[model samples]
Target: MKHPMPALLILLGLAIAPVAAQQVYSWTDANGTKHFSDMPPPPNTASAQRLNVRSGVTTTQAVEEPAAEGEPAAGSGPAMAAAAGYSDADIKRNCAAAQKNLERYEAAKPAEDEEAEVQTRYQEGLSKVQSQIKLFCG
Candidate 1:
């Protein structure tokens, strides 16, 4: 009979291959920029997400930080939107929509007769869309 040892070893290697894949860590910095690296974030980093590249799984751990003066606490604002039950795909879709709205508002030109009113409406819409972008994209 043919030896089974080599076949068993192959199966074991296949099982271990996924575990050997490198992990990717993602976090948004205070400047509202997203970063990804193989290394974990510094201690006390808030809203850090660990991604298993092989399994396509992501887990988030928010380490709360003290709020700066006049600012909301870390992970209390848009950063918590994911933890609020929205999936990453949802956030990405919303962020894209918000960005598109902002672009539309920026490209719009008002007739002279309605310039002031249009400007006011555009400003309001822009502000709202910007906030959404921040919440979803970050």
Candidate 2:
């Protein structure tokens, strides 16, 4: 069984949805060009300004802070879930398992993309499985 391309994309997108805390550091350089970093820039002659990092940011790629010992943002899904009461090793293992489960759901797609029944079942299954994982894991 294989799902339609669009459905697969949706599944992957859902799998990857949800991000962590994001801080945007916007500062104008000596040349007046703005720059962003996960951390405050080192002492520079450039004009620097700090912007408040917001919570519950989703979509934007999260650049790890430079040695800030930061915790997982408020709602970072698997990353946040793994951070609580789990060692780095445990987090890696659980995260890998969660992803593998998602992939398995993806693999169980229907063969006929045009079949409404088949498509619905596959989508429903995928959605349910993903929701379960997030609820239990995250």
lDDT per residue (tens digit) for residues 42-65 in model 2: 686466665555455434347755
Give one clash count per candidate, in the order shown: 0, 0
- Candidate 1, residue 79: the lDDT equals 48
Mark the 10 consecutive residues where model 2 has the least summed lDDT: 15-24
- For model 1, state the Cα shift of residue 40 in Å: 41
Against the correct fold, how does model 1 do in TM-score? 0.41
TM-score, cand. 2 = 0.33
Question: lDDT tens digits, residues 2-91, model 1?
Answer: 999999999999988767666788888889888889899977889798877754555464667777875444565344777688876787
- Give me the overall lDDT of model 1: 0.77
TM agreement with the true structure for every prediction: 0.41, 0.33
